[model samples]
Target: MAIDILSHRDPKVATDILKIQQESYAVEAELINFSDIPPFRDSVQSIVENDETFIGYMIEEKIVGVLAYKEEQEEIDIYRMMVDPAYFRRGIGESLLKHLFATMPNKPVVVQTGKGNEPAVNLYLKYGFEPVDEVEVEPDVWIVMMKKAQ
Candidate 1:
């Protein structure tokens, strides 16, 4: 397995990331009981046009996980962290996250996930991300924002 920066502007790369994103977010949707999560509405064109930097986890040269983030003046805002459902329990998400921290050290990092998604919440907490806020994105659907201070 390897972690590498992904060029979202490339059609093939954007398509691959979109596939993993859709599949991964589908599981999160089911877990959170919310079908309208924004990532589900994203397209390859939208990904290609996004400002966030993308990093991919590859196994035998095929992308199976992805992490996208934006670098702010004082912190890093993580927009997406996803792994193909078929590749769950294989530590792909953890690997991608660790790669981000290792490459961009000394910066505070922030992320948001479905409040009810235990796996995601636990993973963030395990990495020292503390829940900072919770917002009701829709009726009874809460999104938890977490942060790891530098």
Candidate 2:
């Protein structure tokens, strides 16, 4: 697998990331019983305009995973970290996270995932992230915010 920074100006890359995001986040939506997830509502234009840096994972020249984030002076907030559902359990998500940690060592990183998404929660925990808060975005739908200090 090849990992590289994705350019917002590249429509094809953005489109591919959108597709993967939809597929991956759909699983989370189902797990959490929430249909109003942001990824499902995102458009290519919004993704480009979000000003987040995207890192894409490719296999055989096709993008299968993506990690996007916004960097601040004191911390980095992970906007999205997803792997194609078809490629789950293959370590794509882990690789993307490891890459992020390696590139931004010792900086605080934060991420949010559906509260009921055990797989995601476990993955974050595996990487030493601690749950800091829970946010209710809709009725009975909660988001778990986790933080990892390097």
lDDT minimum window of 10 residues, candidate 2: 8-17
Count the clashes in each prediction: 0, 0
Cα-based lDDT for every prediction: 0.94, 0.90
Instruction: Give TM per candidate.
Output: 0.98, 0.96
lDDT of 2 at 118: 97
- Write down the lDDT that model 1 would get: 0.94
Q: What would the per-residue lDDT of candidate 1 be over residues 1-150, giving only the tens digit for each residue? A: 889999999989999999999999999999999999999899999999999999999999999999999999999999999999999999888898899899995999999999999999999999999999999999999999999998
Instruction: Name the lDDT of candidate 2.
Output: 0.90
TM-score of 1: 0.98
